[model samples]
Target: MSRRRQLHMFDNTTESELHEQTFTDAVPTSQRYLHRRGETYYFKRKIPTDVPHAFGSKGETHWQSLKTNSLQEALRRLPAEIEAFDSKVRKARESRRQGKVPVASRPRTEGTTKYLQEAHIPSIIERFEYSLLQTDMEERRVMEDDAELDIRLADFEQGLKLKKRAAAREEFSHVEDVAQVLLEDERLIAPPGSAARTLLLRELMRADIQTLQKQCDALRGNLFALPPTVPVAPRDLPTMQTAFEAWRQSQDKDRTIDAYGRYVRQFESENRELPMASISLETANKFRDYLHGCDLDRESIINCVGGLATLWDFYERKSNRITSNPFREVQYDGLPRRESSVDRRRFEVSELAILFNSPVYLGQHKLKGQVKESAYWAPLLGPFVGARIEEIAQLRIADILRINGVWCIRIENLEHDQRTKNMGSHRLVPMHKEVIQCGFLSYVAKQKLAGQTHVFPSQRNTNKYRLWSNALTKWFGSYMNRIGLEDPRLVYHSFRFTFKRQCTVCGISDEVRDALTGHWLSRNSSNVYTSDADRQYPFPAVARGIKKLRYDELDLRHLHVADPFDQVDRAWKY
Candidate 1:
């Protein structure tokens, strides 16, 4: 028999009409899984027959109000509801296959004493405070349109003042879901109808009333606000390692993250991984003592303590449980703060003369390292342009280009492998005339012709820290030691001090000096307001200051080469 003849009731309907009717009866694309009842939209889905119903025996359908009347808003909130429904179905099927009842079906007396702890009270209060804040913000958004809200809020406050249980119960009803979420987050089974659950609900209601009272007082034009009480850490407090991972994720620089991670690892190893809450001020002081006993320098100990402080601060902000950092203002007995100039002193004119006249600078040294180009140029660039060792080490050939008729080196984090110290560090520094005279431009041209991406192509960053200057920094330190310039303070960074001192001696303005050194300008400074174009093509004052930067005592005439590529290729050979 033909299919049309075999069909029962719609046999008389044409095939085209049947197809059209099928399409018409289907839900609209925009309203999928949505049902409109009165003015609000509800998320509705039919439970599959294969999956046992978890939402009681009411029907084989799941329904949840989207709590919005507007179609677009309902649609926006539909995805989460759909996922919740699917999760319920999956849980029901799993429970059925296991021949076990769901947790909701368990007796109320089954909950343990763990759920009844007084420590959870503060967490409950914190949750209520957050919810109250959200409600206040939402009410403020609609207060202008609804003129009666303030009066109603005042009335609610009065009801609470009268110790009305019904009003508190009504407020508690709205936060039942929030309470449930808190229980799940704490991994506590506060069985329904249990004393533990009752206590939680009672505290939640009390917290709501307290928050509402504060809101009512604010509406009365009281500007003074008390600081919130710090919440107690829960039984399952996060460890220092946990806090360190979280803080590490928040950091943007790889070098900083690696350095901080090392400090945290050392702390955990020494202290045996104590919980964050357990580490008191005394503990911090002891850790400081431990670091001192490790024979670490005063500066290194301070840095380690600072790293701990940063991690503690991050956890406090994130969890809102810890109020004060134990590591803050830690004292180091018998250790005074080192003087800046004394810590990393600028090189003397005689030291500069010795350094420039060294075998490495004169191309007569037999140093066995691949970072020859970096070792050669980094020190020169540091003293002349005030570029950091890492900055000069990571420079690309493309970074060397003339802008607005001035030779400029662009320090930026635009490339995939490049990184600046910070946002202010990304700038254009005019090439010092002395740097150009020292075969810098000629070397850059040679590298470009050789199709090299980085200026120091031989210097490969193989370390986990991804520091391009790691090899060169080590080599420079050793070289300094070998050349009889072995003062502990006189390292690579001393070149920056040397540069700044020269600028000061030559009467360079603070603005121009900071600009050349990539230092952040003050917010009130006119340089902060300068346009991007002006920044890229620095003003004549900057170029003039670059030109004025002169090392008159140290003669680099013999060090200057007509062609740097024609010199010995020992540094280039890996």
Candidate 2:
């Protein structure tokens, strides 16, 4: 154990009283160099000294000196000096071994705990393993029924392998005998008949494979792992989907299921060949093509795949799952998310004729499949009642009320109000007397009435109401083509538009029309200030307008106008 060496790194300056040192005044101990640097610390420069000496054993060239300092200063410096000296010695010895300096002697403190931990990590691991093996051998010296030693041995191994992030799995191999027994017990704990057993085994196998894979991935991910001269991209990019599930969780659960379905369906149908983890940009483009060609409207595309783009964001934040989200870079574009024109406000003359006729209020034909017979009545009531699908779906037996002995359905704040879209929408609408007994209500008394709630609740699956609008439109289109009455540019929503137009032509006030349509006047101004009573401020005036449209254009005779639908049936009954 030869005496350890030291280097004195100091700068020469014109101090009032100072001496020179053999080596230079080093920036040692505290990780920092003593300099008048920017906004950091107050200066702590040591007073200079003229102490020159070369202290090294034969054939070795090393700088060495001794200095007197306050006890606190020496204590602060000693640790740094020791470390720096060791580093320099190792470097110099390595250089010498390359035929440059001199062969090195090992330091006296080399056998100490700190030195051994830092310098010989492998040897420390090997020794711990040997101790465990010897302990096992000692246990073997006792009888098989030595329970205390067995517990001690199990504890020892458990202590050795406490962390999931493994350290020195090589030494772990020595604990194989106990590990095997513990593993066997774990295997038995998973009942053989249960799916949990297969799941547990698969998980265990996956954990091992993934843990090493993660380590390698992390090694590649260290920013400074590559040389400073190399070019690198910051692993995160715009296209990465991260934490979207957390976002999607905040949405309504039905919407959540719809969103998940959109993605699942896309993967199932188009990207079937691509793994979710390995889905590439080309596949996303293919998906985009598949979506565009589905004949879905622009709004549907936005609804379905907006959820998916959000899904990609969640994918981006994942580390072990997906290092890079391929969907992040994928560009998804579709048609504008607005109805082109609610302006073509015409009622298909034929459909309107049926309401004007109301001839025995006949149910035309039975609807097949997921639809009901009354489903044919939706288009029958749409414009005539000014009912939105959500309002119609939530209709119950109780919400309908008679005012002044006039039979009218009163739509109130229906149950499941959370399902409605727009504000001021849950308000009541006074149904025409004919609409109440339209057979739609008679069907409702069967759904277990609690209050004057949703009127046609059987149709209210939140989705089922609008399902028939398209089929009805197509059927009407073909019927009109056969009948030689040119098809009109109208949709289900056109019902409300026609009702509003007739109200306007009949000179009903804007407020009454809005009230009838369950709309407020000034969304910002009208909602807060105007009450429903105020909305229907002049209903008598509005009823006059309703009468004019009932009589003038529908071209019903005086008796027919009085009870339009019954006219044709009454004539024959007469």
Candidate 3:
């Protein structure tokens, strides 16, 4: 709570034997300090409770922790902290006595400061610039010695001539050759110094007549002495694969990357070991066949071809070397339309009784949390909710919102993240009260997943949906076959069908149910607005769809599926 006094730390015996109790400052100064342990520098601070932050301000963000959960441990560590401070004080004093200054406190670089103050200035047109020193220029010129320097100096002087006022592009009239062009030529004429350069040029022309031979000698020495550096031209044609690679780097999405990677693979057999540019339309068509042969649907085939065509267009834009888009006008069929169907399967009055008493969905597993909730109720909800496997398997504990007075289950996925799927895909379906009673909250709490983690998890998350389709198909199929039923066609998608058909039977309006399950609103009926869009609907109708029906019976004489209490004598005798 109080600042420690500064000690003139010296005499190692007295320092080590004295109290080494370090106290943190209420306000820390940024100046560096050496700590006693390993001579390490550390930032030390103490925050008061009155300071504003979410956590009580006494909770320090600087020190890792006081380490002791108890006050005794805290007092135990304070001395070591003090010892560290004393060591730092001793080191600072020793450094100053040795006549050493920290590198940070050393003098400013004199030559570098002056060089940076002016990099470019005006020369005849008076533009003086900091010449770029080639990183290896000095080493390269080392072998030449003074003779080479003479040759370079002569060339530089010859290149510095003020040409006779003949260049119509008068901005470039001085400086016989363009060396480094910084500013564009368009703005140089109206410059205030241009008039000065013009007057200087006219005088130089008159003087050049007087020393003609020296000018000629200088020009000859430069021209005959040095081999001119020929400007290298870029490669003529952009090879197909090279252009595609440049196209790939330009893509900024995962889908585009996958699309391009597939297109590159499509070139197998043409250049199996290497990607090459397509020469003609026939090559592109042949590649299209290869994609089809791999059993790619029409939409996927179009994706690969369309990706290539776009890549070629990008190539044409970047370099004039490419002439045409090889995949342009290439036609292929698109994906087939999907027909939506409904699952009408549910517990009938008699079948419902059988399910409640059925060995498959009940027994010790049904004794309420005797095992994992999934071991028992996955069958019931698996049949009733009609949800997709991952949607159910990866459900987070928090997605069930207890909003207002109602509990609703929200479903979402990567498709929802990108906003690509239809509105129906992301929704909150009000769960039936039977489920609320059947251990939903208890399961979430048991798994310790109420906040941010998945309600159902595995040792690894990749397996979340792996058992979905095939498992659901077999689970529901065997149930139908196990009982005396003709239907084995039911799968997880049938769950959606079951809910909708049930919603219809309950006489609930189509709009609310569709939104619950994320089905499309009837665009036609939406235009003809109904009272359903009014302030609100009566709650009783909704309760029928979501609450479990209670039987008016006693002594477990009449439990129900649709009727949960059909008494079967010695139900588990089998």
Q: Which candidate number would show the highest TM-score if scored against the true structure?
A: 1
Model 1 lDDT on a 0 to 1 scale:
0.70
The local lDDT score (0 to 100) that residue 456 gets in candidate 2 is: 37
Candidate 3: count of backbone clashes, pairs at least 3 residues apart or interchain: 18
By TM-score, highest first, what's the ranking? 1, 2, 3
C-alpha lDDT of residue 497 in model 2: 73
Q: Is candidate 1 or candidate 2 better by TM-score?
A: 1
Writing each residue's lDDT as its tens digit, candidate 1 over 381-447 gives 8788787888888899888877567877888777867787766677778888778778887788778
Q: How does each model score on lDDT?
A: 0.70, 0.42, 0.43
lDDT of 1 at 97: 39
Q: Which stretches of candidate 3 lie over 4 Å from their true place?
A: 1-358, 364-372, 382-386, 412-424, 437-454, 457-490, 500-511, 519-574
Q: What is the Cα-based lDDT of residue 428 in candidate 3?
A: 56
Q: What value does the lDDT take at residue 311 in candidate 2? A: 65
What would the per-residue lDDT of candidate 3 be over residues 1-574, giving only the tens digit for each residue? Answer: 2222323221111233224444355322322221222222232444322221212232544332434333234345655765554554455444333322112223322111111001111221222111212212333346457666566556545544534333333444444223113223212222324543444444334433323333344434432122143211111123455656778787544444655654654443233322223246776787676555434446556766787687778777877655656789676644452233222344343444454456554552232221233434454554345455546755665565554556666666542212213334565556665555555544555554323365544312322323323343445555655656445434445555656666666565776555555553432235335432222223344444455323222122222244221221122112
lDDT at 151, model 3: 69
Ten-residue stretch with the least lDDT total in model 1: 104-113
For model 3, the local distance difference test gives: 0.43
